[model samples]
Target: MITYSSNQPNLYLVGFMGTGKSVVGRRVAEALGMVFLDSDRVIEEKEGRAIRDIFAQDGEAYFRDLECKFAQMGHPKRGCVVSCGGGMVVPDYVRDLLKERGVVVVLHASVDVILERVSEEGHRPLLEGEDRRERIEALLQSRQGAYADAGEVVRTDGLTVNEVVRRVIGIYRLNEPNFPL
Candidate 1:
């Protein structure tokens, strides 16, 4: 069993859409006995609108600005689990800020897997185009370096939600000094 210190820094989960950040993050937070926060959800709540609406009404740049603000001052507690949106870590400043605050784990999956998982969701602003697969591929390729630089990388392909949560907890445990193996 792994026990977290009261001083344990928050765990920030960063990944593309459909990589299970929100789903896995909830379980990880429950396991760690901490609060769970999703950045996109926070933004939506603050703006009184959905993310897709924000993007459509205010443009991606405006949405990115909101993301940066959230990265800076949205989180209200420590020893929590934060799940960031796909494009949140793309900005160097945001990535640096997240890294400074806590462990940034990048959850990843193949483009095909991402497409399959996100195909049913119509709320993705970036996938509003005709060829969603192509958009996903292009976005993944463009953001690959940023994701790699975010933190420890975990592949979610062919893995169940519990398996992913276990892996994240294992990785997190390795960073703690008082964890009992």
Candidate 2:
């Protein structure tokens, strides 16, 4: 695993949709004085199109390939807090790629919480449909195991953002004690 000079491992946050990877990643980065980046945003900027457009036009296979490429590009010059797209970790290759770079933390939420969190979000292309909740539940069932296989797993049920950040930081320190938070 890649190690930072401060003896801290780069934190890559992975989770199902609506688990607040982006929001919590920002908070974690700020708390740890590290940079924050979202892989989906990077892909969107690179493709000059929204993720929905890419998926709608090209297909999920194309998007998944790009996601793998983006993840393989590795972490920042210093340590960074990376917020991966929801489906990014479903593939085993992506999981291995992340493991090589630094610590992987999967943020998990119950299906009900996930559905509620994503219900009003129009930008979530994957969750669009008549039975969005059921779809998300099915996806969660398939991915929860892979997510659990990551270096650390944090459930974001009743916890505050601060609590989540603290838990992540604690996990990072445990994984790479050489790095300072």
Candidate 3:
């Protein structure tokens, strides 16, 4: 029954790293006249360190717990575009929670595109080791189901940021129970 009216509802963007979540999220927030937030950035500000440092010092389990915490109550429940960290929606409860809070859109790109996009970024903790392609493939394969159930899936490959933003808004509008998809 929850649907966006004249006011902007919370919009969540979830997917693997380098899938244009943050970029498209900013544009979407601008188009919708809503606030924009990146979960990773928020967590980093709160923890006072980079995510790689968090993973290195406390390990991934700890970082994941932080992500869960953020999903639970770290950000506003409405009127914002939340660009979630790449595995934030892996947990069913968190994904379900985000869906209930608002629209959860999964922005996806092919493995090659992901590789190309993230190849230069040294902040990826999970993809730091050798054989990054293999790692991305394996991780994507493992989270396929979770991502599928996350909400609306938007493929970002070959699409401009504005294009993706438009598509996300379109999807969100049609997601109301009474509206046609």
User: Who wins the TM-score comparison?
Assistant: 1
- All candidates: CA RMSD in angstroms? 2.8, 3.6, 3.7
Clashes of each: 0, 5, 0
**Candidate 2 pairs with clashing backbones:** 6-179, 6-180, 7-178, 7-179, 8-179
Q: What are the lDDT figures for the candidates, one per model?
A: 0.87, 0.82, 0.88
lDDT of 1 by residue, 104-175 (tens): 889999999999889866678898866989899899999999999999999999999999999998887776
* Angstrom error at residue 66, model 3: 0.2
Candidate 3, residues 1-181, lDDT tens digits: the string is 2333334558899999999998999888877777899999999999999999999999999999999999999988777889999999999999989988888899999999999999867678998766999999999999999999998899988998888988998887776342222
Across 98-178, the per-residue lDDT of candidate 2 in tens digits comes to 887778889989888888888757677777765887888788888877888765889999999889888988887777544
Name every residue pair that clashes in candidate 3: none
Greater-lDDT candidate between 1 and 2? 1
Ranking of all predicted structures according to lDDT, beginning with the best and ending with the worst: 3, 1, 2
Model 3, TM vs. native:
0.92
